[model samples]
Target: MRVQEIPIREIRRPLYRQNDQNKVKALMESIQEIGLQEPIDVLEVDGQYYGFSGCHRYEACTRLGHETIRCNVRRAPRAVLKMHLA
Candidate 1:
């Protein structure tokens, strides 16, 4: 496993729409003030990243003009991917 500062444009979320704008704004403020306490979860396939969680954080980072983000990468069984859908 490795941690790297990835570009915001390279990150992708399976979900098409985003909700909770206010909450996301709040999180953005918090992150701006105190930095990202928790790294976002992601899965990489064929050199592409898919967000498993932290959709709001991703948006916040983008809004804050963050060039990169902290991400955790690991190898998981295919079942984990299915479970993410549920």
Candidate 2:
């Protein structure tokens, strides 16, 4: 997988809405302390990136006001596509 830096504006929420406030904070701390343990996965469609996984990590980065995030992106799978469409 190729890692790329994508602007935060391009990131969309994942299928499941993640609103765990505590978890978000913890993740943010981890990110701050050690950087991202793994790159967030994304799917690109018509130039926009939809989050495929790593919702918590994504939110943490957003909280940190990251201009861009490291991502391993590819075309969306059928299920992943449906999630975005839903």
Candidate 3:
């Protein structure tokens, strides 16, 4: 799979609830300085990709005006992962 630009709105996990603003900010800064070292994990369902992790990274990329992200796609039954996320 290749890295592609996906809309920020498509990011499924919420970034603000982690209560690690300072750390998140620092990580974002680092990502901006050195670029994303790790691609976020995501799963495709019904033709759309939903993030399973890296919510902070997603937010950081959005703030940095990134239109797309490098993602590691995992193919699985949505019901199983949805339960995991829930």
Off by over 4 Å in 2: 14-16, 76-80, 83-86
TM-score (C-alpha) between model 1 and the true structure: 0.78
For model 3 the local lDDT of residue 33 reads: 90
Give per-model TM-scores: 0.78, 0.79, 0.74
Candidate 2 lDDT, 1-86, residue by residue in tens: 56899998878865677478999899999999999888998888666788857878888999899999999988655676786667
lDDT of 3 by residue, 2-79 (tens): 555566677566233563677678878998899988888877666667775787787788777888787876666769
Write down the lDDT of every candidate, Cα atoms only. Answer: 0.81, 0.83, 0.73
Write the candidate numbers in order of decreasing TM-score.
2, 1, 3
Clashes of each: 0, 0, 2
